[model samples]
Target: MQAVTFQAPGEVRVEERPEPDLLARDDAIVNVDATGVCGSDLHIYHGRVAIEPGFTLGHEFVGTVVAAGDGVTQVTEGDRVLGCYCSACGNCFFCRRGDFHQCDDGRVFGHGKTLGSLQGAQAERVLVPHANLTLRRVPEEMSDDAALFAGDVMGTGWHAVDQAGVRAGEAVAVLGLGPVGLCAVQAAKAAGAATIVGIDSVEDRLEAAEAFGARPVHLMEDEPRAAVKDATDGRGVDAGIDAVGHPDALELACRLTRKAGTVAAIGVYAERVQIHMGVVWIKALTLKSGQANVIGHVDRVLAMMAGGLLDPTPLVTHHMRLADAPEAYAVYDRREALKIVMTP
Candidate 1:
């Protein structure tokens, strides 16, 4: 099977790789139908997130189950399915507490050895461990493009709004209009936010956010803090979602949120970054930060997608053959595409 492999910073190669097989009782083998090139994948591509060279590199995918072990009853062979990016041990401490994302024995697909050595779904086939919790049956009416988001990007957006407790008639601001940011805007709207602000420096992204029913705020030309204040009648927004994994964005989220409001940082943060502790302390803001628990939230995301309350199909700006993954990565790296779906 041909799979996308990371060779060095800013480089991905499509090369023949061995197909994956079930190695655990809870595992299933999936014949990938479509997969996505996500922002997190870009981190590994840039070597900002270290991974072994030649590691299979992709996570978001919708596929058909080719085979399943006896323990995998959530989905069956030949079932159309979409999988969460990470696999968790159902008996782990965090898993018992419903924090599957923090499972001590969790393994993230396509993230290299450090993340579990699990080969990615970018290939012709992928081994899905803990299939009972990691894979969900795709809805009959849901397009592959939409189903692709249920496991990752869309789930993250929903998590941001869920964690922030964005209530109906409340105002909220989302920082960084990337795929996740745009999805966060949609989630906020679905959650009944009366005023949703989408902040970004990219004109196209801002436009996209506007289409998702958010008022776009340019990060450079417009004062986000002022915009939030004005929109919220000088009290700042009820909640702020930082979809950009940067110190600046985080700081802005804190500043734009009303005192006693919640801020959900759904972006990927790596190293130690400076924060204005005084502001957080003074405002008594509720800060929630971490990766999304897609496994926990996938069902909710799927329901929203099925009900037409949330649609991410528009977010998919490009589609390419799996053979063209290298070109796809280059296009995504240049910021030419929002979501790139690849078929095997």
Candidate 2:
């Protein structure tokens, strides 16, 4: 099977790799239908997330179950499914507390050995562990493009808003208008936020955010803090989300939120970065940061997508054959596409 493999920084190669098979009673095997090239993939591509060379490199996937072990009861052979990016043991300490993202036995696909040694889904076939929790059937009406987001990007966006505790008639400001940022805007609206501000320098992204009912503020050309303040009537937003994994974005999110508001950092942060603790302490802000609890939120995210309350299909800007993954990565790296879906 041809799979996208990491070779070096800024490079991915489509090479023939062995197909995956079930390794446990809870495991299932899926024949790839469609997989996504996500912003997280860029971290590995740029050598920020160190993975072994030649490791299969993708996590967001929608496929048909080809085989399933006896313990896998949620899905059967031939079932159309979408998988969460990470797998978690349902009975673990963190899992029991509804923090599946921090499960002791958790494994993230395509993230190399440090994450779980699990190979990725960017191939003809991939293995799925904890199938009952990791895989969900795709809704009959959901397209592959839309179904894929329920597992990862959209779920992360929903997590950001969920953790922030946004209430109806409240205001939100999302720092960075990338896919996750745009999705955050949609989630905020679904949660009944009266005002949503999207910050980014990219004109296209700003436009997309506006289409999603957010007030677009250019990161450089416009003062985000002032815009957020003015929109919130001088009190800062009820919730501020930093979708860009940078110190600057985090700081801006803190500044944009009200004194008692929450700041949700949903972006990928792999290392230590300095933050102004004085600001957080002085404002008594509630700060929530970490990877998204997609495992715990997939059902809700899928329900929203199936109900038409959340739609991410517009975010997909490119569709290519799996063999063209190299070029797809290049396009994504160059910021030419938003979401790239590849079929095997």
Candidate 3:
């Protein structure tokens, strides 16, 4: 088999690798048909996330189940499946409370030891752990590119909206305009937000958000705070989402949310950063931050995608063969592509 491997900072390669097999009773071996170049994968490519060199390097995947362990009863051999980026042990304390993202025994694929030491899916095959809770059957009519987002990007986008409690007809602001941010715009629309403000510096991304029913506001050229106020009659939006994973975007999200409103920081935050606690304290804001509960939200996201209310098909701006992962990483790092799907 062949897989994408991180050779060093700013470099990735496609090379021969041994195929994965069942490693646990709840594991399944999937012959990957399609995998995505996600923002998290970019972190690895940039060497920001310290992953072992030569480790398989992707998490978003859609494929057919070639084999399954006996304990994996939710799916069977030959099932076309999509896997959540991380696996959760259903019996864990957090899992019992529906907070599978924080499960005590969770394992993230492709993130190396810091996550779970599980190899990635950007290859000919991947081993899915806790298959009954991690692998989902793809809807027969859904395209592979679209189905792949259900387990990761789209689910996280939905989580941003859901955690913020974007009520019908309420106003919402989504920071960033990357795949996750654009998906958040669509999720806000699907959740019946009357006003959706999309903030980004990229013109193409702004245009894409506009097409998704959001009012695009350029982050640098435009005043996002003023834009949110102008749209909401000076009260700010009911909810705001930080999808950029940058401290600046997170701060802006806090500033743009109305008094007593909610701000969901779905972006990745790994280091200590200053936050204006005074503003939050005075506004009575509710701040929620963390990775998305992907396992918990995957089914809902898939249903929304199938219903056409949340379409991410337009987000796929590049398609490459698995062997072209080197170039794929470069294009994504340059911010030239929105979503890149690689097929084996």
Candidate 4:
């Protein structure tokens, strides 16, 4: 077997690695058919997120079940599956409360030993813990490329909208047009948002957002605040989503949200950054930030995909073999692709 490994900052290598096997009764082994190079992978590539050198890297995956432990019954051998980026102990207090993302024993894949020594799916195979909770059977009609998002990116986008309490006829603004941001646009529309402002600097991304039924606003060329205000009749959006994990983007989300509105920071934030507390205080804004509970939402996300209410197939910009993962990472790092699906 071969897996993508992080040897150092700005360096990822594709190398032979041992195959994974079930390590627990709740575990399952998957023959990875397709995986994605996500923005979080870029964090490790840039050394912003520390991980052990040579650690397997990548989480987003869709595959076929090859083996399952005795306790794993939700999926069986030969079942097509997609897995959440992380796994939670079903018995945890948070898990019992439907807050699986905050489960006390949650472990993230491909994040080195600190996140659970679980090797990543950017390989010929991966070992999934708590298979019944982590893996979801892919619908027969869903493509590998599209089903891949049900476990991670699309789920995160759905979480963003869900956290913000987006309602029918409400105005929403999504900042950033990456895969997650773009999916947020689609989710907002599906949730019945009457006005969605998709903000990005790239023309192509903005165009894609428009195709998703959002009113695209260029970050620099067009005034996002002005456009949002006009769209909301002088008031800012009822919900603002910061899909870009940067201080500036977070601040902008604050500025674009109306008083007493909600700001959902769905982007990855791993470091300390400054934000205007006074602004939030004066406006009485509600702020929510954290990782997505993909395991909890995968069923609904897949249902939406299966029903044709949400389609992320358009976000797939490239498809490559797992052997070309190094090159794929480089392309993604350079922003040359939107969502690169790598097959093993």
TM-score of each: 0.99, 0.99, 0.99, 0.99
- Model 2 TM-score is 0.99
Best by lDDT: 2
lDDT per residue, candidate 2, 1-344, as tens digits? Answer: 88999999998999999878788999999998999999999999999899999999999999999999999999999999999999999998899999999999999999999999989999999999999999999999899999999999999999999999999999999998889999999999999999999999999999999999999999999988889879988999999999999999999899889998999999988788999999999999999999999989999999999998899999999999999998999999999999999998
Worst 10 residues of 4 by lDDT: 112-121
Give model 4's clash tally: 0
Please report the TM-score between candidate 4 and the true structure. Answer: 0.99
Q: Report how far off residue 191 is in candidate 1 (Å).
A: 0.4
**Candidate 4 residues 239-322, lDDT tens each?**
999999888999999999999999999998878999999999999999999999888889999999999999999999999999
1-344: candidate 3 lDDT, tens digit per residue: 99998889998889999888798998999999999999999888778899898888899999999999889899999999999999999997899999999999898988988899999999999999999999999999999999999999999999999999999999999999999999999999999999999999999999999999999999989988888989999999999899988888888888999999999999898899877888788999999989999999998899999999988899999999999999899999999999999999
| Stretches of candidate 4 exceeding 4 Å from the true structure | none
Question: What is the lDDT for 206 in model 3?
Answer: 99
RMSD of candidate 4 to the truth, in angstroms, is: 0.8
What's model 4's lDDT at 282?
99
| Decoy 1 TM-score against native | 0.99
